[model samples]
Target: MARIAIIFLTFVCVFGGATFVKSIEEDFIRLPLTSLHSRSRRKADVVDPNAKKVNLWNDRNLQYGINITVGTPPQPFILHLDTGSADVWVPSVNGDCPYLCKAVNKYDSSKSSTYKEIPGKTFTLGYETGGLSGSVAEETISFAGLEIKNQVIGIGENQDTDLNSYPLDGIIGFPWSGATSQTDPKSTILGNLHKNGHIKKRFACLKLHQVNEQPGGELLLGGCDVEAEHWGRVYGNGYWEIPIDKVEAFGTDGNSLDSICGPGSSVPDCRATFDTGAAVIGGPSYLIDPIASKLGASKYDENINDYIVDCDDQTLGNLEFTFGKFKVVMTPGDYLSKDGNTCTLGFARLDDLSALLLGDPFLRKVTLLMNQEKDEAGLAKSNIDKPVARPT
Candidate 1:
């Protein structure tokens, strides 16, 4: 959720030290780039627009960061699946948004008989590149038959500018204070859903992909998607957490490289996290050669953290992990399909040390079902091999 400096500045004074929002009104106050809306203009109180109409819309995308297939035209969008931020926004008919962001045909609040302005819910988003300032107001929100009453949405200013390469309307975040703390950054989508009871005792599922022109890519909630559930019962780990089995190293000669594993050292452990937002398979560089050797796999560089492989090259193909007694395995086809003929793949040195973020490539192989209330995520083998769920 990239809010302009003003929004962040406002937060500094509020949650900065000891200020949780004093009032609902103070939550989204900001200085607009122009005098379009008076600073003194009050924000609107969100009302349940759907008290009248029921939308059949399904899987609306969360703007910014996270990538998913949202809304009509059904284009895949990257949104901020954050628990730290709130408000679901996407490009509108304003023709002012760019970077592959297309406006969604949302209901006009003006037409909603129940619409009411709480007065003063506008904000500005600041990103590393540019910024967007807008007003926050009440609006209709729904997807896959799941609807929330009086959802708070941000109405970004219709300005022209290129801020970041990844573009979208808004971020999906929830008011939460979970694993995030003063020492670490915070996010809260799960927390918010738990607050609203949208999710069961509290966890969600994510079945994301890296924007390919294929079917069966998405992030699920509460229950698992048909395709993602192809395997078996989903498993849960601490949200975004994984287990450490072992860690080793290798040299340029492709043999086992000698290294030390320690509690505080980077190269010494196999503990890692599973973040769907990331792009590539990242972890320690040292493990690359060693793991490949252990599997007897061949690698041909692709100039990036990727390569071409001969899937059936007699390498100790396929990798496996067991959480409890359940076995979740990554087959030869699961590594990274570089040579489709024999099922070959490749890897990249993620952090030079430490575990990889384990992004889309891996997520699609399994289902990450996080329990919001419990703050744990379950990992189950994907039924990807099933007849109905197989990719088209």
Candidate 2:
């Protein structure tokens, strides 16, 4: 009952109350995301620094993969490249999956000739624990090397039992085109490769990789890696939004000691969704009950409804979230996590105070681009600067 690290992503559900902040029709380019504190030995660069990359693997940071191939003479699988999903599924050898789709490889479509079968449609999905109910075809997927013909997949058939525990045999929603539940709202595979032009720039860039390191994150499609320093630029309505502008509780010189939500309260200007499937940082419950009672964290003990915190007083103060004039800080080792000492407190609660998903413990500490050509969204700090190879 008390665990706090959810990632689900299919339709999104979590409920509680209070956290609103929506109304930015578009127009934000502010920078200075705290300059990520500065650190440069120089040499890092990106602005297409060769673009085309698709390497990700990490499953211990909880999830991240990319192997894909799909249908018509393709096959292969792996997936989970979800930027919080938008469509592109798996687990179909005619459905009936169980052992978490058994190490995932399925998707026969009778061996594919480019599958195709969006007839009576079915497609369910949804996961915070379960639900798949598939069948909704149209294949020819591919990845990184690029090649996305028909797209719109799904397949499953019936699932639950926690999809067998996931070893990865599904999920590939790079989020965009009508944003998932797929029945073909433009087929999203990068919006059918930017509507047939095959991408001149529609944007996509994510890096995430830390806990054990070797996954060497990478997902740049279309273009953007432009790193060199603590990047910035925010604005959304297209998904990747940010403008929390306040969350509060900080001391030890960090300042702010009050206001747990934002602006004039009552859930006003709060916004927070970055949703890489949402690993945790939900919101509402009057903004996580006063930042979990000034970080002493308790209540929610329905045995394990979770709120523990004390992994050594979780870094001793500082939680900030500002986002419009920058700020972004999160010390306490960034929200707290520790299994043996039993820490837990990445913040959770939700009913939707307008928006607040910010998942993956605040996106594995930054480095995201998502600029659907001017719709804007870029954040910095996670740049180890390695991508620049593709050019066969």
Candidate 3:
């Protein structure tokens, strides 16, 4: 998915220092999410309007999704909560697609009393992985006890084969209004929520659980978790991009590898985008090649475009990413994924984009908070040691 920022306009308040102003009696929604690959031993909680919660699901640590209903009577579907793009879309039963669309649920407008077709209006979205094109329509969409009436959404007419690998019915984009296909900002789901006074603050917080955890994590809409530690300010144009002060690697003996970037290195001024939709990190080959070599991953597969490494290597060390004064360290367990005996480096080569794409591998360690109103983002170490048993 193309990295983009969520845009909005609202008053800013100091989180850790000052008192927070509650815009509404029911100010925030703490939605619980599930992972498709894991089963939970927890039970569901009652839905409290004051603390509205919804069920979300994760697909093999690659994607996280939520359950939502559309139309009057409410037809349910599992939609991916994508932060990299904007626009809500579902597979349409009326669409020409048959093979992949049949694998999951499809939106049937004819059965929906509140469905309103927007003639001649088409929705098209593209991402680094795949793309989709469809027709535009409006319907009453509900999720996590919150109802959005007449919310514009896409009914997929065509889809890429690559998307079929995931266990999802559709996508719920969380980027800015400018990224949506709709010309009117109010037509987008988040935009409509803001205009309708459903969400007081124009911000969202994501806490992704560890891969081994039973249930997934929580996604907070309209506010940040006060308990989580806050990091540096976000800086970029239209994406959730941040500046990197340095990237350092170490061996099992704690000896530093050759400097990748920052002071006294060939390259300086590194930047990265936080993307929830991406499963792995991606950067220029020039930057990744050195890190891969230092880790003893010298064999690069031309067809797969990734370096193959030994999964049983117990001598690997940590990878540190310094942003401003804050540092995030990833152990070998966090950066390398093992499938049987073969293991591949989580970081990939993306020569097309200048900045690195920091995906789930990096995000899993932090609770990312994005403020659309301020065009800023923040991060905090995830409190995964004490997982919250949310409604799922």
State the C-alpha lDDT per candidate: 0.39, 0.58, 0.63
Which lDDT value does model 2 have at 389?
18
* TM-score on alpha carbons, each prediction: 0.50, 0.36, 0.79
Q: Per-prediction count of colliding residue pairs?
A: 49, 15, 2
- Best by lDDT, which number? 3
Candidates ranked by lDDT? 3, 2, 1
**lDDT, model 2, position 358:** 73
The segments of candidate 1 whose C-alpha lies over 4 angstroms from its true place after superposition are 1-89, 92-140, 149-187, 197-200, 206-239, 247-268, 286-304, 308-316, 322-324, 338-348, 352-354, 385-392
lDDT digits (tens) for residues 254-309 of candidate 1: 44443323334344445545543233344555655555555555574544345455
RMSD of 1: 15.9
Per-residue CA lDDT of candidate 2, range 265-323, in tens?
56566766676655567766777767767655765643433476555552356677765
- TM-score of candidate 1 against the unseen true structure: 0.50
Best candidate (score: TM-score): 3
Q: What's model 3's overall lDDT?
A: 0.63
